[model samples]
Target: MTQTGASRNGLPVEVHHNALLQLLTNSLILSHTTPYLSCYDVLNLAATSRAFRYLVYHTPQVFRHVQLSNVKAAQFSIDGIDRGGETWRNVQVDENLTEDDFYSGPLRGIFSSLRRQNILQDVQILSLDGLSVTAELVHDILVDPSFSVRILSIRDVKNMNERKLRAALQYACRESRPEGTPRLRGLYVFGPKEPAPELLLKPPPPVPVRKAAIPAPPVAKAWNTRSKKALKVALVEAPEPWYARRGDQFPPRISSEWAFTLMACHGIIAFDTVLCTGPRHLNSPAWGTVNIDALNAADVPHYGVATHSLGGCASCGCAPEGWTVWGEDNLATSREPNERRTSGSAISEVGRFPLLAPPPVHSSNIKAAMCPTGQPVNPRSCFPSSTTGKREKACFIPRCFNCLRDRYCNGCHRWWCETCYTGPWATSPGGHGGASNTGADLLLGVWNELP
Candidate 1:
């Protein structure tokens, strides 16, 4: 018997064609392989050697179902649009492409090549991130008779016009799809933007008043909560609160531990525990509880305690002049000793009040700070004295004596009137404040640490 390929126990490989096909078409391998690879990976494999080329080109089943979420478009250029109208003449896949290259990239030649190879007609499942699916490209895909895409998912694509996309999907589901076209079974639209790190974990507080040269897309760092070593490293590297430098401005207050739990319950923060096990308890729905305290106690990564330091004026909400611990009962402030008021060294320790309720402003006593040009400005000028004209505004209307009646912001630590709670920015990047579900008494707010 002529030797083919070696088998176990040092036997000569005499596998039948059917057996070879069965090994290659194993459901477990096929399902597991595509998720960890890019469509370019299949294309590249098809060009590697004669045998691989044949396997990839002939096996439409392997390449037809693709997830373009992990690929980046910047690596490869489209023929006409990005590459100066050059035709795709290369028959070989770039051997230098690394694993990092697997992440999402442009889909310029992906569909075109698939269409030419007659693979597009058989496509049943497709997952596209916002970057891969441009409005124009989506329109083309929907209009093209070749794409029999059954399931479509779009996530975190910026500037994606939902209205037009939905309309196109509706048309494809109703009229544009003809015979041989697979009926759209599901259409899912995930987050319009990537979530901030603070939403999941207590991140290293941001550098004070510092801006990056180039802003990058938000990336949520994965934490292996199961590992204690990983958790220890993450906490050790966490940022400490910085004293306000001469030119720096203070950020918002973070939420209390109890408030964070409430936010977690509302699906605001995507905890790894919640993500892996799921929101509901396995044994009973009512028993579904996130063990935040235990996680924090264990020092698990991203589950650190949320802290808020007292800063600025409690009443007018002005920036503090200087950092000083005046007394146990009250925070102290004053100008630099022996320096004139015009020298810009005014410092004062303002009164500490409940985050929910503001203390009555006594006109006779003001904790004013010196302006940049060395002139004292009343803190009241910094915020709106009256919020009557503004409807649907966020306000911390004091309906009770306790903090329970007031919602606190984990971001600014400023107590907003109830009207400001329901504004568009409530859960947004700059607006990391909780609001009660009811106008009068919902203690809902998260710390806004997102840039």
Candidate 2:
């Protein structure tokens, strides 16, 4: 190779390359080196140099856990629009583009770029919740011998089923270096799921009997074993007990794929919406309580994470930053250019404020890392009122997303207050034929309201 003395940065090309190679040799991804940052930065870094791109893609040691959220194949069509003619009609002139035609055509070509570069194996958190994920796709992504994915998130994949999910989970959990060490941590799906068979285990086998010969004495048995060892024959190994992992329940119903997911994971923050769908108890073998119903049925993976009864909510995970301060359009523009952030870094810390009482500006505001999730307002009131008076304007009131008290009223189903919660509602349920209900002084504003 020609020794390029120096490049533009006042450093030799070899020096720069060697420096990067050394750094890359070490872990590029760590607890603090977020997957979101690395996945985005890799594209930028890869674009800078072919050497870097080759190293990033080809180096099996350099792994990255990427997130692919809400990516949909592009669809285009040509139309014959004769607005000037009689009826202002519109007609289609081209065949509609299908998934087969444009399967990886979204999110700034990130999906296609990854596949084209042949680095799908580096993606550890696969969130293809917007596409028609199939058994084939899952196999290609996680079932490979060199794959490093831990958790998978999927949405409405019409071709997929719970049985397929179980198979994928079985393959993902097949790491046996130290026994029962699963590679895949969990599976997050929010789509059409076939019913998981509640009863997955077969009946226990009948006990074997020594029919013909009498059992040898202990010392004689040891002597016979020593004799076999002296013969240098491969001994038939005894099977490991299932009771260790599956447990000793009379009929282990929790041994389903859903249960296996929880079993594999070590621990979770109370805020990971993608995985923490419902009462996801950790560590214990009592996983019969968890199921696919915990996930959303009508939306993408993170989009519809309902507030879990076990102290979590959908708001904290999927919602973009500057959530409360900016309008929807403004929030869209203000989101970090960084790749998606998950509950990967969340800890056990949460607020403990009272309901209807706003938190301190420093703690619960949108500028900081948003942690506060809604709980249910007590005594659930539709706020029925009776007063034939001049109505007020729709104010910008801050209410929980779960209740949606801001834009829901008995009359027109609309209410908003910039500063007031109980000051003469614009439209009340009382004027109409409604029953008596009231709001409770909530604790830290429960969706403690997760129920």
Candidate 3:
């Protein structure tokens, strides 16, 4: 008797089984390397067979870093006036489309269904912009204990309110935990302009200065004695202080305008280095020099000046001359424009001058030579730019012992501009430093460095 081998019609059953196993193995490997795979891809695989469905459901990285944008409500209506003596109203999505469009309907349905399965925890970064979702919806996602989203970046959100934004930030910060905590490490919220402040008070100091400097002593003397029988003392005049003989010109005194301007300038600087050379008609080199001198006088350290070229003269506009400038050119270059200020020659002129150091040719390999901590050095971080327009009128008031801007309201004890944190509302005015407050007094407190 001939035994019948497993077969379907003319095909052998063992041959079919091997083909199925091979296809399943290949699909599993392909899913690992694919980046930004949409939810539809996973759903299609799941529908292919029960074995494929299991693999798609269990893959963690497939749903990681999900980015969704331009999502609007299906029933929303847009109204526009037409030129043909009629108003045009358009309704794009309806019941028919919802039933027929797999992406707009069935895919959304699948995501909605998976929402209950806690599959969204696999999403590490959720970037939502120009979506019709409300702030309440954002809060819900952030507060959800099961959601593992770590970085939420929402930009160009026109409908978002400050209260909602602040609430969402507070929730994100609160929900973020050390362990088992949603890895929500950062929250970036940006818009065209800042919302009217609930409260605006004098920003805390190191008042913004254009070219703050560290002044060296006027003279250096060495003690000399001729034998024990005859002891002689000599007094030598020290070389000129960096600012000596220069006019009263110095860096701008730190003020609210300075802080805001620096923030604006830094933002421009980060995006394009050429912005440093841009025109500044309002404030001249002398103004910046005075501000720098004030910063030096205040003994506020941690800041450094950047210039086009190193070791160039302060007057020639070629080197970083702190607060000093020689006409249109930098101080050093003005004396001799034809001479090249090399390291050896730089020491000869102006005794010793800091030269402009070229930026790293390849930023990736460039590392800061010195650590910022334990010393006076500006901590460089990626900070947002100011949204306020330039040339916003800022009043500068000189309160003797301290050049304070915007009068301090005694009732509130806070210094304020026309907008917020004005008289009677301030918790503490003249807090940083003034005649009312002692220099050593812990009024404004000390600068806190960022990690």
Candidate 4:
């Protein structure tokens, strides 16, 4: 075991505390219980003692995914969590607080206070909406090695107009990324929250045509007309499988929520580079690199753009470097959406949504995700099947190993369906695992403002 001493954040130094308790909390959170614990439960524990305070705040895992909006002390007071009474009351109120106020002061908001106290010292998935953000702040935060923010949301930020938004994205381009860049995967930006009192909320104002990378969205047509035309097109192309067709117009099917593929070596596989078009956004037609992955999934030219070409090869366990042996999803079958649904295939259990950042996923954390419920999963283990999957230590992919609906691996470019990665492999590959559309679930970052 590691020496029981100081945390990575360098806090509560030389203070006597219970090492056993800290270890227990860390063990339970990582392996057994789940990703999130109730805030009320965590804060109540923090209020109990100083040793517990350091344990809770400095542990880093507790705040793996958090939201700290600028709310007055009174709001928190009503939540029933004891925040040391005087601390909340004494704190000052400020709405337009940016990254500048990360210190102990009257004007500092909760976001800054979290930074000042090193509360976010090890945070991963972070949403900093409502704060007035700047372009330089976003650039510095993403580039900073100290912070491990993967996916960030800066919705409703004040003055985050088209110009500032463009500048923020330009900073994140692979060309501009300096050495020691974190595994920053995706960035989502929606329009302001709580803007109008009476009017309905709206999506983000469209990015200027000059700034956008993709072509303009198609004009809307009558739904009846479009659906009938779409069906005809799918029927004509139904003879060929998705994976079999060469990407004459665009890359294989990909989600707008998921941008480029994050190669195992950490280099991004930009879709626009190899193909004429990129993945369509789930909502709008706007395409973005280092900024947005969004589009409408249903439409001509955009048909089948929202999903991946599944069932290529076994991706979960260790197979040969090249997946020459086809897995179950690769068998010859009808390609029609309706007929394809009936065929036996390895359906990956829905896990974490692609839009969000994954939790602290070391090899140790993966065991929990692999075995979602208390019961053992289908493939049993991600260890190679030929071997007994028995060893003192297990080797798994470090980065890019996630609960992505498509169990895609960048190293081999394969799809590891739920049947392959879980409890035990049946005699027949990809046919049996008992994994359905639901059931298994996860047991499952940062930046600044501009001036």
Candidate 5:
């Protein structure tokens, strides 16, 4: 064995070198093969080997992203394991506080260490509702030139509103270098709705509608009757899926509360079918590139209008001369009284009814002509399958084909369902990964398995 280091510190040279080599090999393998493995898993592996400990100390990049919740302060330590090579040391001591309190502990130290060593490039923090660090704290780490964070997910921040959240995003976006464009690419803000008292104090603005040139038609007597009948039929046919087991239980199906919260915070509305709708508020020129479901046949003639509009297309910027007519038609057709009643009743029972209002006008702009009341045209069709070459299916679930519910198309790298497994969106021959619906199918299976 070649001995090189000054024998001052009590570490054996052979042990140190062995540890270093093991760490380098592990890091290299992990970096390439299992990039998405959690930080906890990586740390656990490091705890098994002295070389791993030294490697972890030198290479902070291994801890690029960390998700810590309600852990004891003692559970955290500068070194993952103790010097004795046996026990794990506890760095902090907080016994009374819950899991959430521990994670929000002035994470300045972790941030500083990562910055100094250049380890953290992406991070996600999950916490309890109503628990969030100040925007100032977030800004300090995210804006620091030394670190590069590409994705940030914060869960359970109840007090954060669109405006404050937007401000924080703007600051982070601004700090990124133009050439590099180091953005917080994927941001997922989640939490329960603020209390009723807070909502009552500041109710959301009413959804706006542009005046139509033609007089509004009288409420259709047939529609009202059909709607009520449909509701009764629906209730009889399928009662609400039991949320929990016979005993106590959290709702098994994703609730509107979760869906709407994600929608309002991230500007993405997720439906039961796994379709994700774009933010209805993002109508300004800056947000024109976002594409969503068409509001109605009258709003946009084609599926690309919303995408073109959001993407800053010159054609969409100029409001078409007769656009309002289309908008009006879409707004009228998009309204499903039966669906509305069901949603309204559900909301009212939870005491969150006041928040429900007419869907925003912007949403109407993307309303596809394929809805039940849609014009006699095809709405955005679902992905085509290999067997059904040209035909497209309708996504009955809340999610769209492009949403996470389906497998990502290898050819186009876009989300697509089984029906859309062929064509240009099909798995490319020499692509990174072939199109596989395993993940999505597993999730669906899990949902089905739920009691």
Candidate 6:
């Protein structure tokens, strides 16, 4: 083990507590040495002794980026964990106390005091890792004095009523007032295999006309049969298949080969990325760059007004600019309602209601998208024999690495359905044995940079 000390003749010299404190808190020491320590390291030092704890606890700026990893539900309380606040009666109470205050206990009182006094008010980024956080805690930490928190992260949190957290944050955003606290700007929520809310599962928009027409290239009959046979043989030898255990919850297919191909193609569940062994790559800096301003800007025509093509109006028999003619056509078309059931390919119209158009996704239904759960595999594992999926390259917003549903990696310019080669905006590769969603964690900095 490595040791740090100032020793004479291989023996450490004893120093007075006051002298040690002076040395540790010296201007040169803090500026030159403390900067070398990470927030985690500083927190560890704070736990070592009272003097160190006093310095670290009071100095919020030094530990601006706080990460509570795998923190248990029991630790959320400040009652027995700290001896700082011994009496609730002695604590100052203003006229704002409500009737509910009488029923609350010491921990709530401690949190109330912390908020009233503005403790942790300067913290910029707060990451809540694990599922132990309660709605009450969320409500307490995100209101008034604690509202300055800019980025709030929830990782691998399961069994959480996300609605409560969302409600609390919405309230915080709406209620920041007299104190002028900054509302939270960025939110990151990720889970390993959690189910998403039903609202996000809107049937994927009717397969567009262009995509429905593209047919897969023909393959030899013998090759297809051989692939199916090989897949069955492989699956028979493997451990319990995830599909068999999950029942019809996963994508449905008739044959074992088709099942394997469908899962691989859609990337419903991926263990290959998690099980691969190699050195992890560092995130590319370019992932931080995004034109959010342009994305959110009102839709605008790229061409100049004069450059627009002219067309003769069918009814008026006069040359009109392309946009004006288009607008007229759109207005005329708008008067006639589109048929809920349109004439299209068999697959395109499947599973849609014949009586109603697909409803728009409202603001309330969005939640974490989850990858399908499946059997783990090693690096040498192979897919169904002779089954090759097409490479997808288009990207979308709010992409997720776990579930390819309705999203894609913006930085990689590839669909989230792929199994390899993601940019920094995607999930962390498994080689480092760190969190699988490191990209989401790093997103705090990117979001905080926004105007």
* Residues 296-414, model 4: lDDT tens digits: 12342321222322333332332211111111122112222212223333422211111212222332122222232222333333444466553222111111112223344343344
Of candidate 5, the 10-residue stretch with the lowest lDDT total is 304-313
lDDT of 6 at 447: 51
What is the Å distance of residue 121 in model 1 from its true position? Answer: 1.9
Model 6 scores a C-alpha lDDT of 0.33
Model 2 stretches astray by more than 4 angstroms: 1-41, 51-55, 58-63, 70-118, 139-142, 155-159, 170-182, 190-451
- Candidate 2 lowest-lDDT run of ten: 350-359
Scored against the true structure, residue 204 in model 6 reaches a CA lDDT of 37
* lDDT minimum window of 10 residues, candidate 3: 271-280
Candidate lDDT scores, in order, read: 0.36, 0.34, 0.33, 0.36, 0.33, 0.33
Model 6 regions lying over 4 Å from their true place: 1-6, 9-54, 72-119, 175-182, 191-451
Q: What are the per-model C-alpha RMSD values against the true structure?
A: 24.8, 30.9, 26.4, 22.4, 24.9, 25.5
In candidate 6, what are the lDDT values of residues 1-451, reduced to their tens digit? 1233534444444453356567777644554454345455776887888988887667655544544442232123334423442444323234444323322333344445546645566455565554345555656655655445555555445335556654554455443333443244334442222223343333335545675576545677577767866775574442222211211112321122222221221211111111100111011111213222212212322210011111222122211111111001121111122212222223211111010101101111111111112311221243333554422211101111222222232332223111222234443443221223343433443456547
Q: How does model 2 fare in lDDT? A: 0.34
Q: Give the least accurate 10-residue stretch of model 6, judged by summed lDDT.
A: 351-360
Q: Tell me the number of clashing residue pairs for each predicted model.
A: 51, 20, 36, 25, 34, 0
Where in model 1 is the C-alpha error above 4 Å?
1-22, 25-32, 44-60, 72-108, 130-132, 158-163, 173-182, 192-451
Q: Count backbone clashes in candidate 5.
A: 34
TM-score (C-alpha) between model 4 and the true structure: 0.36
TM for every model, in the order presented, reads 0.35, 0.30, 0.33, 0.36, 0.33, 0.31
**By TM-score, is 2 or 6 better?**
6
Those runs of model 5 whose alpha carbons end farther than 4 Å from true positions after fitting are 1-50, 57-61, 74-105, 121-131, 158-163, 172-179, 191-451
